[model samples]
Target: MKAAGILTLIGCLVTGAESKIYTRCKLAKIFSRAGLDNYWGFSLGNWICMAYYESGYNTTAQRVLDDGSIDYGIFQINSFTWCRHGKLQENNHCHVACSALITDDLTDAIICARKIVKETQGMNYWQGWKKHCEGRDLSDWKKGCEVS
Candidate 1:
């Protein structure tokens, strides 16, 4: 019984390290510091909305596509074009592993997302942005946040 209890505690600890869901204001502050607040004319609200739709602000979100490609992290960056997954050949413009994006630390994810935005049609690379964040009044995304 003692050993079983230890194992359960270890499992809980491991699961706790896997993912984190961030609040909107917390994300806004982080994104602002990263210069994503108005980068490429997209407001902070756009990014907030995108993150919500993509992974619900969860850092450990990952999805395997029908094409065998996988998307990782809050932004759901694709392995096929952005990051390398296992033995697959990838462009890897961000030069980071797909696994790196899934951590609670979002530094790698934000860096990779910036690269994707610069290379592609801005935030259009993310379908979530187009479907949810595009051309809408996004002032409410950062409404009460003191991000400066």
Candidate 2:
């Protein structure tokens, strides 16, 4: 009976873990189709994780500041700054968010992110995600996104 119970618990845990990855994979397709995949070089897996950390992938995400301005979009661009990089739109603009990511050069966001990952988290930090999401198929990303 003890061995059977342990096996059941492990099976349940594995199922839950698989479900989470399925959800993240769906979200990855949305972000990739929206233009973020063009300007960002990180893996869709990593980008989905970052979006979860930043704003739960909410496109209408916004933050209010003491100065009374609004920040908008999935990657969270301040209204004042959005105009500098992208077109104005009633709805959040994914293209603008993508452009802002390339602030200095086309590859700036990816290179900068790698540098940050190294400086703050140390080298090989991305290995952590592989451990966390072990056994998940990230290769499905190619079907959903067109690389720039």
Reference-based TM-score of each model: 0.87, 0.37
Candidate 2 C-alpha lDDT tens digits along 5-84: 99877855633322122245555655566454524345565555554444444443445557654543333344443323
Whole-model alpha-carbon lDDT for candidate 1 = 0.88
TM-score of 1: 0.87
lDDT score, residue 33, model 1?
A: 89
- lDDT measured at residue 74 in model 1 versus the true structure, 0 to 100: 91
Model 1 CA lDDT for position 27: 95
Candidate 2, which segments miss by more than 4 Å at Cα? 1-23, 34-40, 84-148
Off by over 4 Å in 1: 1-17
lDDT of 1 by residue, 1-148 (tens): 9999998678547544566899999999999989998888888999999999999998877787999898988999999988887888987888898888988788999999988888889999999899989999999999899975
**lDDT score, residue 51, model 2?**
45
